[model samples]
Target chain A: MSEERTEINSLGEFGLIELLTKNIEIQQASTILGVGDDAAVIDHFGRQTVISTDMLVEGIHFDLMYTPLKHLGYKSVVVNLSDIYAMNATPTQITMSIAFSNRFSVDALNEFYEGVYAACEKYGVDLIGGDTTSSQKGFVISVTAIGEVAPDKFVKRSTAEKGDLLCVSGDLGAAYLGLTLLEREKQIYLESPQLQPDLENQTYIIGRQLKPEARRDIIEFLQEQDIQPTAMMDVSDGLSSEILHICKQSNLGVVLYEEKIPIANETKEMALKFSLDPTAAALSGGEDYELLFTMKQADYDKIVLSEQISVIGYMTDISEGAHILTKGGNKFKLVAQGWNAFQQ
Target chain B: MSEERTEINSLGEFGLIELLTKNIEIQQASTILGVGDDAAVIDHFGRQTVISTDMLVEGIHFDLMYTPLKHLGYKSVVVNLSDIYAMNATPTQITMSIAFSNRFSVDALNEFYEGVYAACEKYGVDLIGGDTTSSQKGFVISVTAIGEVAPDKFVKRSTAEKGDLLCVSGDLGAAYLGLTLLEREKQIYLESPQLQPDLENQTYIIGRQLKPEARRDIIEFLQEQDIQPTAMMDVSDGLSSEILHICKQSNLGVVLYEEKIPIANETKEMALKFSLDPTAAALSGGEDYELLFTMKQADYDKIVLSEQISVIGYMTDISEGAHILTKGGNKFKLVAQGWNAFQQ
Candidate 1:
């Protein structure tokens, strides 16, 4: 990084926002107005709009010691977009509000916006209105995503039927394993400044943690294949926890098979290296940003043709309760041991 | 003010969210689904949707020493609603995301939500969605408001003409005075515990600061009177600064009269008590969530009929520049010393 530091106070809040958003091009036809104004205007004439919000606090959601600011910006946008995709909606616009202390310079903010712009370019979403202010301590980010879906195509998490088959896109546990590796490396670097991080060998898992992508492609594929999920959500708080959320909301029970859970080979190896159970890691590890849904059994044939998806379970009557069947022929109740920031 | 305190960790994140949002009745016909889903869905079929977001950090935007949690919650939501009304739109829904340290308890959160619920009821807007998580330090709030306006009825800050008359709703500078009084009381209390705050005579100004309301009524009155503003914005950052924004965006200039500025008698007295200029306070002191707008000269008669409205200025040619005409007939260029959070 170059040492050319520019004080944020030199340019006022409005100046900084204008500088950052100057090159943002509106690609969504629904967005009638963006940035520059008191509020953004959108005209989604025939489609229903979906809205979701998320906040990430420094030291709570991420550590600056191990995470790059650019990656942080990208991941922040991706996380909010995941919620939109979880509703089977195509994200059209986002408003990003950030507060940072004076410890950061203007160049540092430029790098963060570069990542934000890159994400906007990749997703073809417009950057709308936002508030930029100062924080008393570390950095804080809040993002709100707006999306559009056909009136009859929007999905909810409380409409799954008892005979629906549970499905998830992409492999699980990699992001959590990646987080463990990064935390370990951060500890080693803190103890001895001369030791460089041995991150080359763990590139895949590290990328999973640092740059997880929202499954917009999955939503598109489901639409192309004419498959409408009965209930859907993103695997942000782990597969087991998300499954339990769907079942509880739908007033049904579920039976998940341990062997059917898809854990990447690299993630499984890393879990064992840390002396952790691979199955448990896949079940309870969070932040994968993958789509998890329940579809009718009749739609199973259409989904099985896609290699990116895995069928892990099936919904059952409410009397059966929620449980996981082990490969060794044992059944245990599934509990939500997902990561909670307030646990300490 | 209750002595009952329940630890947040005992109920977990999901339980706490459920408890907070269980009774959030959806009042807007546009809101299809709320709270329980991954994203809330709204159907604004023929109307143009307006979106705005604002973030309030604990120590930066407000001080907890004199700010009740309930009042803080109410003010946060009102500030965002003010932006929606600035666009000549009727706010329909809001998403409130908050982060706080564990020093807060469930009872404290309930108090905050009570205020949020009160604002929703008063505005007839639905609480559609939000994210609640832990912060490492003080409290943080991010609120996003969504509103709707007719396709051609929405106002912008860049549409004023040279002959338009400048108008303002309600008196200004009172919120800043209220803040000064609160800070003084806090200082006195810090010096001697036995010194009780003498706030009995400062009720009006203090209330203006702590519980500022968005001018939804002004928007309604304009619609009812068949009057549309050529340009409009909210006075969150004081009159002079907002006037400069309108002039710059609209490629015009303005001439504001000092004698015409609407400073309340209570605010003038409070400013004199603190040895501050009342006109300067009205010009630069911020946080007065009033509406500043421009209308055709022909509409002046209709606006003056309402006691709440004031005609303060008029738009001029671009070469004239923005200036304030003093009561003594002296003219001075209006510089935006508006509240810049980045300035030390």
Candidate 2:
């Protein structure tokens, strides 16, 4: 890698944007326009368009000390794409707008865009259009993802019915545990500059926090199996909070079992080592970009063959309320202690 | 109007979002889903979807001290929508993602949302989806606008031909003058807290900068008159820069007349007061939010009757080069002194 640092002012905003996006080839047929215009045009002639946006602020959503610019760029795109996937739609295009302060160089921006392009290639989504501007402070990234779905095929968070099976893709609590490990390491390094961080054992958790992928595979798997979720949402704000959201929006109650919740062995070990309950971390810890959804009982056999999924619980009548049944047979109301940006 | 400040943490991000978007009624039939979902769904059916995004960073794009939060919100939406209109499309939906620090209260957010809703209602566009997060410093807004256009009807900046008549909608340079006035007043107020701003006569220019509108009417008028532009773009980065963009993309040259460039009396007076050339201001001063387009020479009589339209100049052969004819009959190459976000 080159250590060249080019001032962004040399090429200017337009020049930089052109250089970054010049090599992008449109993969989606829906994308009629991509870059080099005031706006991009797409033709979703026979399908419905699903759109979602997410804004990631530096020092709030990421720490520059630990997070690489490329990873940040990739994660930002993934987060928004995750929402589109949660809609049970295939993401086709994304417009990413970013504002960075003078502290960053053109090379740094290039690296970030490299990550963005990598994600675009991996997901088969076109980079349509975006705005690049200078910020007065830290980096700000906003990505809007557009997906397409067949008519009446899109899933919603409010369409779950009673007796629906609650399911989640991938393991929980890993990203949150990863964050904890990184924070601890950061604190140690800050206190003692000579200290060498021992993170070899925490690779999985750290990676989960640093570069979590959206569950596009899960959506594809569901499609391959001919299964449509009655209600769905990405487990961004933790399993507990997202489940609560499904229950609240669907006007029903849920019963999630602790033992049934999928937790990676490494994540569980890390949680216990940190004197934190694994179940609590999985329930309340956020940033695990997995899919949480509910499907009718008729689709259970179709999904049961998949090893990447877990049947956590089931939806019940509204009067039953939202609660979790522990391995010890204790039933308690689920509380949303998810990551709140406003919490001090 | 009430002097109430509510901490956003009390209601949480979800609660605040619900409160702000609760009253946003869906006006566009294409909007299949609006808010309360992982992603909003739109069915443009046969029409091509036009998408554009813009990111506004505080202290870079706006100064919150003089720019009201409401106006800022409205302007942010308008800026993105303007890009969609520049493509000769009908804006159907917008997703606005915002990042704000702890200094802002829930009331402040509500005020911003009030402006957002106002724009949505006025434009008859749906507020579909967005992400609201905590900023480390000042406010950051990113808005993605989605519009629909009939097949092959959407205009581009790169399709102008030789002999096309260059046209502009509304007057130019007022917004730049407005910004100058506000900045001067801000400096005076900072130096002497006791002095009141003497802005009694600069209302038009001030309002132009504070609340610029996208030329949706111009699009409608063009549609009604059955005139399709050869090329089009919003006059965002000044007339000279936008014209240069059109010329560069279309692989043609232009001959813009100095005397024909529309300038408002208020703008001229303000520019003169600041010891600036009015023509120069009209050429390079940006943020006008007006339409700059080129149409076939055959459509001249159709647009000539419009009071709001101005025939600025005409497109020329590539060998002619892009140049502006001065009022004194001297021709000079058009230089792009557009707002470069990266310039120190």
Candidate 3:
């Protein structure tokens, strides 16, 4: 009680991390890199090592009212694996740690792990080690994934370049819209228990929110095409926030085309039904888990035709500012309003 | 409720992990090892990789009634670094994730991270990445530690040979005794609200329980002496259980000396006060976080003697059985009563 207490909000998450790590001394000669990338890179046994971790808590990250445990398990793995892919590394191993309240019967945990197993199998990642303990309340899952890449082959978010072609894989904003639909349905169901909800047409958008996939295939495709992204990151915090990250880190600006933005047909339809703008959803909706990267124009011919890949925007000098070319060809300044769990 | 339900208890933790990992395929050639050992081993550009993870849940692992948030933070990192040291690797990078209930004020979290920062500075590890989110109840901390070692220098638990000398670093059972004392005090305080429990003389044991240190120093000492352990593991799950792990994995048996089992004077006194046997406490009491290992007998002369390192036993042929030689010259079988959190 004698110790002075300080508010975590004062330090924030990033500030706390920096304060904790500021005095750490790297003593190992083999620790080529540590604590500063999408993944912790270790130089060991002549290979470049990559490690990443993510944790998700119930209510904070998901609501079980509409979220299935199986999808939650799959998404947990996908989110963590996304960090490995962000480093341009191939994930090979993962350790899952979970804490569950007694309210969850043993059967529920089995169902959760079933989905986790499916994800591991689908991604070709080994479920290596983990710990399970009793939580005081709702379920919590933490996954740490280890990956590998050629020493020089790994891409970092800090390497974005001026005039690089900014690209994104697959469509975006569906997950956010999907989440909104689920929340509204839950509210309506609560108000009138006997009302039958309409969900047949919203499956595609809902599926994106409930079960997201890491862009591991995109990593493989890039390798096959012999093209390396100059800088890359996963679109977990929306396109606007992710682009801002690259721009800030790479010291450049970006120009995105609103008309060229890839929004799935289902997503657009749902946006209209909800009276929401597809562009707004694409810009601000999070948890897409898609890849956003920058590459040289020369390599465009190799990847442009790929079905899973999309060219959403390009990078420019810092003075150019981040702009979205509207469908009418007018320039609009881009802004980032990504989800920050800490912000009230 | 209509979904088919299966129980997780039927498949235990290890079984569940096995089931989940059965179909996983490693896609990266640089991943030298995964899903086993203390941490996943990746082949980096220059050195060998080491990684390990540990999860601590409130109520199951610790009681916030007597546990300071700062100590909990420090202990979490120590538990993880201990595993890295068990592999004879250098602790370098760590990612920490936590879930806290709203009952915990933001000030409490800042205090917790301050302790984490202190330990990070003491251990020379960087806080690279992590996630923080709201917990429905209680607190959960998950830490993943990454270290590095030379390919040839990395120690494993499956290499002990016959006649190998079994060694342990530091005294044992103090942490367990500390828990017993704290529990008694807690019960007493619960019975009488006005009671003030005296713990002036219990500092050593209580500190062991509250702030356990990882044996990274032993690793440095061994390297300085150029003595490589044939087999090694951290004594996190009691001395007997850890020894059994090495024996089972290495296909060997052990003959332990009762008198050689190191116990601190304070720990012995506390056990006697609590009407418990000190030696028994040292054998099966968990959470000591000390190093227990075996080395070839011929290498003993190369390593200098230190008070911290005690020769407790010798490995023998599997047929010999794991036996403890008492001062009375009677042989007794060793049993591992390892802690299982899932058990009632």
User: Which candidate achieves the best lDDT against the true structure?
Assistant: 3
All models, DockQ values?
0.17, 0.18, 0.46
TM-score of 3: 0.88
Question: Root-mean-square deviation of each candidate, in angstroms?
Answer: 13.1, 13.1, 4.3
Candidate 1 lDDT over B1-344, as tens digits, reads 75544554445433544543443444445544344311233446767777888899999889989998889888988998898898898787777888887777654666677677778778877666677777889999999988777866778888999989999999999999999999999999999979888885888899999999999989999998889999998998888888988998799999988899999999999999999888878888899999999999998878878978899999999999988888888778887863331122
Ranking by TM-score: 3, 1, 2
Model with the higher DockQ, candidate 2 or 3: 3
Off by over 4 Å in 2: A1-46, A338-344, B1-45, B338-344
Taking candidate 1, what TM-score does its chain B reach relative to the real chain B? Answer: 0.85
Q: Residue A156 lDDT in model 2? A: 81
Candidate 3 C-alpha error for residue B318, in Å: 3.7
DockQ of 1: 0.17
Question: Which regions in candidate 1 have their CA more than 4 angstroms from the true location?
Answer: A1-46, A338-344, B1-45, B338-344
lDDT of 1 at B42: 44
- Candidate 1 lDDT: 0.80
Model 1 per-residue lDDT tens digits across residues A140-223: 999998887786677778889998999999999999999999999899999997999977498889999988999988999999
Per-residue alpha-carbon lDDT of candidate 3 for residues A1-344, written as tens digits (9 for 90 to 100) = 66755555566555665665555566555456566466777655556767788889888899988988888888899888898998899888888998877677666776787788788888888776677776777888999987877877888887988878888999999999999998898999999979987685787889999998899889989999999999998888788888887988788999988877789999998889888878888888989989999999889999868988878788999999888777877677787762221122
Q: lDDT at B272 for candidate 2?
A: 88
Q: What is the lDDT of residue A332 in candidate 1?
A: 80
Off by more than 4 A, model 3: A1-37, A45-47, A104-107, A188-197, A224-226, A297-304, A316-321, A328-333, A338-344, B1-36, B103-107, B188-197, B300-304, B328-331, B338-344
| Candidate 3 structure quality by residue, lDDT tens digits, B175-279 | 999999999989989999698986758899999999999998999999988899998989987898789888888999899898999999999999999888788
